[model samples]
Target: MKAKTQRLYLVLGALVALGGAGALAFSTLGDKATYFYAPSDLAGKAAPVEAIRLGGMVEKGSLVKTGETVRFVVTDNVETRQVTYTGILPDLFREGQGVIAEGHIDPASGVFTAETVLAKHDEKYMPPEVAGAMRKVEGKVS
Candidate 1:
């Protein structure tokens, strides 16, 4: 092959390799991604199958504890979602406070069975995801 033809083939091969690598990276990352949603966002839609983070305020008078399992309602003012966790909760977890629960919603019952529950550490601290979600809800209301 001529020198010019060899150079053309090399460039094409390099492009193909780069495209393949990009595709692989995106696919791997997509599987690991966990999406965030507020209670209102889930209204009127089927619960998702994959793991996700649900962010909202713990509704007052909605918490119920039974042995190691605890259940509560998370609300975005317009909608509510029930969350159940089977482990010790964070010290800051309380009613009328912000929380983010990581888990999957049960398709049969439409309840979120949380694997982990996170609460705001202090009066001035709120998770960015929860803050953003609350802002979105407020924008809709106003």
Candidate 2:
């Protein structure tokens, strides 16, 4: 083949390889992506079947524990949702504290079944999503 023909084939091959790599990257990342939502966001909306991160403050007087299982209500003041977790909770986890629960919501009951519960590491620390929601609430209140 001529040099020009050979160069054209090489360019086409590189483009095809790059496109294939891009497609593969997107396909793998799609499954790993998790969405974050607040309690109010779920209201009047169909519960998502896939795993998601729920961020809000743990409602006061809503925590209940039975053996290894624990249930609590998360709220953004405007809305609330129940969450059930069956594992050792973080030492910082407490009622009236900001938290992010990672798990799937049960569509039938509208209850979040969290596989992992994340709480603030310190008094001043809050998850970004939780903080943003709180700011939005404060903005409306004032």
Candidate 3:
């Protein structure tokens, strides 16, 4: 092969290898990647037994507590989702504020069984993943 062609082949081969490696890594992680959805977005699409991140404002006067398990409803104006968490909630967690719960949903009941609950913080503060989620859904809802 000509020297120029040899170098071109080497570059193309490196690019192909890098692309394949990236595809493999992304595929492996895609299953484990958790996507956050607002209560409105979760409706009809949320599958019971499938773990996901649910985010919305805590409905006023709907938070209930029994022992370490806390039950609340998250709302995104258009819909509400019942969430149950068996862990300490953040001090900032309050009704009428944003919250994100992580857990599996009951396919039949549509209730979320949250293993972790994250509360919305200041305007300048929020989990990066959650922030990204909100950004993703921006303009997609009315």
Candidate 4:
């Protein structure tokens, strides 16, 4: 085979391999990707089937606890989502504080059944995403 023809084949083979690798990476990442959203982002939209990370303030006076299970409302001031979790909550978890819950919404009950819940660490700290969302909501309200 000519040198030029051999080089062309090699380049084509590399491109094909790279494309396959890219496709595989994207497919794997898509399966595990968790989208973040504020409660208002979900308002009026069909609930997503895949797991998601919901971030917002724990609405004041909206927490309820039972044996090994807790339920609360997470809100961005424009909308709220009911979240239920059956596990120990973070020590910082409380109403009127920023929180992030990872889970899927139940199709039948329209509730966010959380697998993990995270709370802000301190009074002066909030997740950047949640804080930005809250600022957006405040701007809209003003």
Which is the leading candidate under TM-score? Answer: 2
Candidate 1, residues 60-99: lDDT per residue as tens digits? 9999999999999999888999999999999999999999
| Model number with the top lDDT | 1
Q: Using lDDT, rank the candidates from best to worst.
A: 1, 2, 4, 3
Q: Give the higher-lDDT candidate: 1 or 4.
A: 1
Candidate 3: residue pairs that collide: 48-107
Tens-digit lDDT track of model 2 for 1-142: 8999999999999999999999999999998998999888888999988899999999999999999999999998888999999999999999999999999999888899999999999999999999998788767767
Alpha-carbon runs more than 4 Å astray in model 1: 1-20
lDDT of 3 by residue, 60-128 (tens): 999999999888888766678898888889899888877878888888888889888887667556566
**C-alpha lDDT of all candidate models, in order:** 0.95, 0.94, 0.79, 0.93
User: Model 4: per-residue lDDT, tens digit, 40-109?
Assistant: 8888889999999999999999899999899999999888999999999999999999999999998888
Error of 4 at 63 (Å): 2.2
**Which scores better on TM-score, 1 or 2?**
2
lDDT of 4 at 2: 100
Prediction 2 TM-score vs. true: 0.87
